[model samples]
Target: MNTLRLAALEALLLTDPLQKVDAVNALHLELPVGAEQSIQDPGGIPGRPSHLEFVLPQKVPRRSVHTLQGRAALVHSLAHIEFNAINLALDIIWRYPNLSDRFYGGWLTVAKEEALHFSLLQAHLSTLGFNYGDFPCHDGLWEMAERTKDNLLARLALVPRTLEARGLDACPVVREKFAQAGDQQAAQILDVILRDEVGHVALGNYWYRRLCREQERCDFDTYQQLAKQHRAPRLRGPFNRPARLEAGFTERELQALEEQA
Candidate 1:
């Protein structure tokens, strides 16, 4: 099989509702690139298993319910998100060529952590009598990736710091729900994800700062403008202040973010 182009790999990463196991296994394959005619054909890759089709969500719809099934479904959906996250991190390393070795190393670390998160969530989903693909999921995460593809600085700023940092803020609430439901296993899984995500976002922040330094610009103000220009969601609080601090967000930056909210 021919090695897929960056855009093709990115398309694969965005395919939503993928079975976690299938998606993980597909990482081992040499992805094929389609021709221009094939690309515009909309027929998708032939002879390749359609076990996963990553598509972006137009909007993030709010879901609310108070039932075990509903909770389990939500957990499965999050698991699917994490599965895509793993692929996204790996694809960054593979698809974006010619970066410093450290860049690849950083993304590799993220890939490993995302995989760990996926495994934890998938195991918990199994305990709930549902698997990773058993529930519908939004594709908002991958959408940001697509939007920032041409700008590495924007990709680092929006994806890890903005989008994934939202995960940091929301994780505590999700953990509380799992705890209330007496699903300590799921709660524990979320704990691991939260911890690792902080580091991932920190890596993003580090790179964003590096890029800013290279361009001789103000990181904080530039991030704010990019966030606005890209229509990035405004962050709300109660913030995970301690985690954000540990994740390389300065007090001034946090204050600026809070002011924006």
Candidate 2:
């Protein structure tokens, strides 16, 4: 039987970006969840395009949003993030088997939404005369995925709750930049992403707490320990309090984030 997890694995291994997006969008959600199966690591986990160049985060030159090329770069950067997001969602679905079936289903939905975000950004990029690979990007998201590969709890705590949560804080500022640059279309695309990402991060919070409960660990404390253990980036502020609240972050979490600021 072509199970849900295996199908997600197939999509994850697709190298061509558009094809991967299409495959994820077309994923069969009705298939059996196959929650108890332990799938082997097939390597080549996240197949990315060959032409895309990855530079260190600092090496990627900053561009102004005022120029057409600069706006294109901005759109391309968001597209790249969405692309990595699709893989991250799929990775969560297939990599950690034996969880509740809802866990896989929730992430599969996220994978499709990530695909939609990518397609939206890609279309906008085309209007700006650029493609995803036309701009240089960093691999920070997938790097965190690699680091959290072995532990499902760590993956939940870090990727969605930690890394993906950062998107919640950043989306408003980035969207405002697009709007200020008169790229309202790009700003609208960001709006869609932000709306969907709130739910994605909420899923992370839900599952992270579920695991912490199963292990009898305090959710906030465990998250703090995992962040330090994984060497996760320190979160800076102007944090999105409303979005974080909607995404299931507790009051204490918000206070800690504020204190971190």
Q: What is the alpha-carbon lDDT of model 1 when measured against the actual structure?
A: 0.70
lDDT (10s digit) by residue, model 2, range 50-106: 899999999998889899988888889999999999999999888887887788889
TM-score: model 2 vs. ground truth: 0.98
- lDDT per residue for candidate 1 within 46-88, as digits (tens), equals 1122454444454333355357687777787688678767766
Clash pairs, candidate 2, are: none
Candidates' lDDT values, in order?
Answer: 0.70, 0.92
Best by lDDT: 2
> Lowest lDDT 10-mer window, candidate 2?
28-37
